[model samples]
Target: MRRLRQLAERTPAGRERYVDLLRALAIVMVVLGHWGITVIGYDRAGRPTGHSALGDLPWAWPLTWVAQVMPVFFLVGGYANAASLTARRSRGGDATGWLIDRSARLVRPTTALLVVLVVGAAVAHLRGADPTEIRTVVWFATIPLWFLVAYLVVVPLTPPMYALHRRFGLVVPLVLVGLVALGDLGRILGPAGLATGNYLFGWLAVHQLGFAWYDARSPTNPPRRRLPTSRRTGAVLLAVGLVVLVLLTVVGPYPVAMLNVPGARLDNAAPPSLALLAVATAQLGLILLLQAPARRWLRRSGPWQAVIAVNSVVLTVFLWHLTAAVLLIGLLDALGVLPTPRVGSAAWWAWRVPWLLALAVVLAALVAVFGPIEARTRRHGDTTARGRRRTALAVAGYAGVVAGLLLNSLTRKAAPEPLGLPTPALLAYLAGAGVLRLLRSGWGSRG
Candidate 1:
């Protein structure tokens, strides 16, 4: 614990290389996981429709364990919140305003991206594609959008959550572990009632653990003085996390790898498991231990500046990358050049390599067109006339979204249901409106 405090104390301010490196790692893993999914086919219900274990690769499950799922993303997010909130406090920013600002950044990009996808889905349906098939594709494509909703919910709670960190620290993770264990025991050993509710709470409990870590590490003063003891504490926490993970897998009913089996009714990932919680703790602990090394390396690298420059665009990429993938696949198919979509075949999986490459090309193209527009839009908080107009526009936009979601729920399908997407679209629209309102106010106040 003392060593841990010393390491953290040595970390320079506004120079969070460890966190940034962890962020890049999380993003790259997420993208790779998504790219892998494109190769694996899905049925009209959005279940995995193919398997790749036939390649006889023994490393398959282990690879999935390392690459798939969203735990790492949430872990890094907690770190960012801690750093950002601490920085904001030093600058005298109000908690409500900070929440509002962060929420706007998250919501608007998602809204812009989802509107494009929904419009595209409508067009595909009109063109006589199987409604169920297209609906399933859209359902599958919207998986990444959940991060926006989850982050918004988690970020605003940071103020209180940070308080929990100060009080409980390591005990926080223990309590979460207990909750997850009880949830798992109920589902796997007993009547299995309310598994869905348990699932939501269970996964969110893991996200809160990240918040706790941030609180422990973040302080208004120099970090070392506040942190109990950095190096020894970090190592012990990491070791404990690993032991818990091994025990859960050995004694529990769940598989360690997160991705669902083809045709499996329930997925470990959709409502993540204790295994994931274990993985997150271990990952977070290790990252904390390596903070000093990461900071030193990042300080020396000029390329990191470029990554930090675009750090704000991570949400934009996650929201729209799937759309870019869909566009690339459709374009190639229309030209009669790309192979047709298939299920349960090695050759089909093989074609995904090139499709992923094309997905990259398409994402770059979208960024080229919309990136500047998004950048300029965020700066709108500087003037009053434009602020008032933008606020009005945002209100109207949110009203439209409410109407659309209600209609979809009544007439089309239940969102957040079996292979559905209600949370992302709804949350995105709300967040976008909030962003517009803020920017308008910022602009008006400046004037």
Candidate 2:
């Protein structure tokens, strides 16, 4: 805490401290929302299972608009990624090197989670745990991977997509919106899975908007950028976003909930509908509207320190919080202490208070366990190799990691389920890493 305070005090001048605050806020909301909604139950034979409260509480649909914070992360990612790319290029860093730097932080931590999940599943299988129970647990644990996989699909595109952002400005996101509209149309029409394409287009739109936010205060923009101008822009965005949202949900084919409710035919969140993009626009506007004052508030050492503390372990918290929740569910169930009040009952709401507290403690312990691995994933000063070989290795390596995540997630499937420890995905990922290591080693030639 003391060190973070000192670090906060030494924060570089002209830094956009509010971005960190927004990210931290988003992480908090995600953790709290997930923990609160997650409810675990046991089958008649004592097998554990899990589900969301959103399924039972139809009245709570509108509340999800504020809770669905994924767009905020992408928004911040855009600003931060843009800043990083600009800075790296300024320092003579190419896209290949930049990709390597970015991938290390994300992939290393993700690898740790996958390794642990595979090992845990293996141990359960060796002990003769029921296949149904194991699959349920694995599915619950890998929920975070859904977002992670989607983000991975987009992360590699930062360089090229960012180039489009620079070349076309706001037109990039506008085009993405058109793409999302097309996707939404396909989703609503015959083949619903066609909307899955929006996972990239939708998030890319929010991310591209982040670039717009960054551009407002960019070095290229006027230094004397007036507050009223940005605020006016924000207001227009807010108005347009709300109008579109109403049209999509009320007048069009989307659902009211911003989240992907279980078993819903039209999931606004899973593939991300235009309605969700509407929500993102509103959230982005709210972010822009609040940025100036938020930065001013973040000037306080106390608030800034908290933001730093959370951001430091943000990935760890996100990765393991659900795991912690799952463990607690089993433990509390065994001890006959896990609450099972009716879904929307007053007693159920009462149980959430203690349930969340317990989950937080477990999550804190998990973060403490895994946070150091994340801390150690820092950028080395080693220069990357340049050439076609370098680009090929980096791209292949990144694709391997993504394939590995997707394959590991497949273990969560029913019917022809994987027995344990997703070996193929693990090998694929290892092979990818080997190629990346070869890339780093200059492809058997000196850099």
Candidate 3:
């Protein structure tokens, strides 16, 4: 607490603390929302079995309007990336080296988590636990990796994406939206898997909104230019978003749920749709309207310190929270203390109280254990430009890391009876981590 206060006090006066606040808030919501909707019970074999409540209960769909908060994260991502890239360029670093630096921060901590999970998988298999069941839990445990994969995809594009943002302004996102709609149409009418392109388009559009916020908060942007987050604009966004959201989900084909519900025909999030973008607009509006007050509140020492503390290891908390929850669930199930109530019943809702509490306790412990790994990864300066051979290694390193993360993000339906990542993908990820570590070192760069 004392260290956090000192760190908070030392913050640059010009820093946009609210963006940090929004990021911390988004992670909290994602964790809690996942905990609440998780439907769980011990099977007849006394093994744990569960899935998203959105699968078992339709009424829970409306809660997604509040629970789905990734848009805010991406928006904040855009703003932060814009700031970071600006700072990097100001320091004379190229995008590739800067990207390598960025990738290491995320990838290093991720490597720790994957190592633990892989070990756990092997242990379970050795203990005669069903490989299929072990893989099921592993898949759930690694769900957060998909977002990491998606974020990694965009992080490298930040330089170019910010370029487009600076040159074209709002038109960039408008065009991206057109692409998102096209992707959605392809999903419906074209060949299978074509619409997956929106995974990048839809999120990139939201990230672009952050670029707008970066400019929105900048004093250098001309005052004569229309402010992106003005109250009037927020109102318009909120109104249009609500109307379009209703039209798409109610009158149009998209499902009401914002997140992917298992067994659903279409997921607004998996391959984001027009509906998800509408949600982003409304979310962005509320973010705009709330921006000032949020900044004001965050200015206080106590609040700013808290946000700082969370942001310091937010990735660790995110990476390990589900694993912690699943572990606790298993423990409680083995102890015969875990409850199994009817889905959507009053008791089930009440059960979330203890469930969340237990998960929190476990998650806090796990964070304490794993967060230092992330802290050690906190980088300040960007990597200097390296030669051609180094660039090739960096490219291969990044490709392998993202590819491995994506491979592990598969569902049972996608890779039937999957029992952990394929050996080659795991090897790629491990080899990639080794290569990246070498690139980070001056000694390795010389050769």
Give the winner by lDDT: 2 or 3. Answer: 3
**Pairs in clash, predicted candidate 3:** none
Better of 1 and 2 by TM-score: 2
The sequence of per-residue lDDT tens digits that candidate 1 reaches over residues 1-447 is 353345445656756566566666677667756766554444586333333342333346445656654676776677677677777667665444455455456656656765666666667767765666565556545656555545555665677776676666646556766776676666677656635554445545655655655555556633322433377767986898778877766575666555655554345665566777766666667766887776677665354554453454666667667667666656665675656455445776777678677778888788776565455444212223333454444444444444434333333432322223344545645554655455536532332
* Tens digit of per-residue lDDT, candidate 2, span 1-447: 778878898999977898888888888899899988876666787666667889888899889888999999998888888878778888887877777777766776777787787778778878887766676677777778788887887877988987887777778888888988888888878576677779789999888876766777745653322122277878887889889998888788889899878977788887878899999888877877887788788888888898988888888888888889889988977888877777788988899898888889998888888888887676644375467767777889988877877787766544233444366777887777666656654462233
Location of the lowest summed lDDT over 10 successive residues in candidate 1: 379-388
In model 1, state the lDDT of residue 31: 75
Candidate 2: worst 10 consecutive residues by lDDT? 220-229
lDDT of candidates 1 onward, in order: 0.58, 0.79, 0.82
Q: Order of candidates by lDDT, top first?
A: 3, 2, 1
**Comparison by lDDT, 1 against 3, better one:** 3
TM-score of 2: 0.93
Worst 10 residues of 3 by lDDT: 410-419
Candidate whose lDDT is highest: 3
